[model samples]
Target: MQTVELTVRRTVGRSLVFQTKVLEVDANRDDPTIVVACPEGLDPLEHHFDASIAWTSALGRMEYAVTTRPERRGRGRVWLLTLTGPLTGVQKREYFRADVSIPVVVSWTDGPPAVSASTNGTEPQTHRLAGVVLDLSEGGVLASVSGVPPPVGTQVQSVLRIDDDEIVHAATVVRHVSLAGGTGVALAFADPSLHGDRLRQVAFEAERKRRRGD
Candidate 1:
């Protein structure tokens, strides 16, 4: 049986919108698989590929990393890649064929501009960026933000740690929408589980309250 190896690719731009890059994966002719390597500094989201994806011979994209290039140290460093598609698993074998994506600070000091949402009654903090999330794999997140839409194939670090554990990560603004009472925005995340215990706790409490009508 032939297998397909999936990897993530990404891009970093001025803004953290649809700035994802697409990589050229050598599609397997005999095996119907694509094997790509994980670039430096990036990681893959782990829980987004649990369904049957229609087999398409098209290449996909994702985010990789943000680093300070040695040569360009003065200007700082940021690198991202676009992969063929999200990694998939071979039946019940080794989970999924994924790459490495770096996780951002729920709210770092000099990190990406993050929108702080306190779980407890704590003071509001910051992360990196904020916007709608797109795709999430394992390593990091992909997001879409405000302002003019970004070009296709551009991956930006666009997530805000609203809470301590349950920070919203890897998201994208699907499109700009208008609502009767509010501004409509769309987003995506890497994986609900990767969000940590706080997010899960919130979900659990919500469910419990709903059941009790509290």
Candidate 2:
């Protein structure tokens, strides 16, 4: 088990440590922070002015020494944090994942070439397919569908619809095959920056919900 420690800093720059385990770090994005869950029967914000947070990971002990402000986002049970300065520590990355099901549209450049009667440089013909994302990470997604999917190495664009929000991303089909229930394919994003942060947040949110049995 991992724990997160919040050290409070007062106007005099003095500090105090408030340790808790009910925290989630959303570090895959450009701006990283720890989401701390408010302890039962107590309000954390009331006890601290500005604070610094630290935790340990695969890399080693990681610390965000800069003073940070906490904002109440989502429900009052949690606080979203933002550091005022650069996070100082070894950045050892270990990927985390969450099981989810989402509908998406996949368009790929794997169709047969067309012998056009006109000779003006032609673009590769593309095809569209629909699939359900079984699970997703910042780097890739596993989509389950019916029938044979595009061959491995196919360059694809996936539009994942999260409620009314549509996020478009570029990916490559790394694996495609038949399953007992349906065809399954693994897609690794060409560039995760297009949707990595958003997907990471979604995965974290899913984990939070599951932990609460919601």
Write candidate 2's Cα lDDT for 46-123 as tens digits.
544366666544564466654444456665556656666565765555334567889988887744465575865466
RMSD of each: 19.6, 10.6
Candidate 1: residue 3 Cα off by (Å): 31
Model 1 residue runs over 4 Å out of place are: 1-168, 175-177
Tens-place lDDT per residue, model 1, 139-190, is 2333343443333333333444433433545543344455443333333334
Work out how many backbone clashes candidate 1 has: 54
Which ten-residue region of model 2 has the weakest summed lDDT? 13-22
Could you tell me every candidate's TM-score relative to the true structure?
Answer: 0.26, 0.56
TM-score (C-alpha, index-matched) for candidate 2: 0.56
For model 2, the superposed segments whose C-alpha errors exceed 4 Å read: 1-94, 111-116, 120-125, 177-180
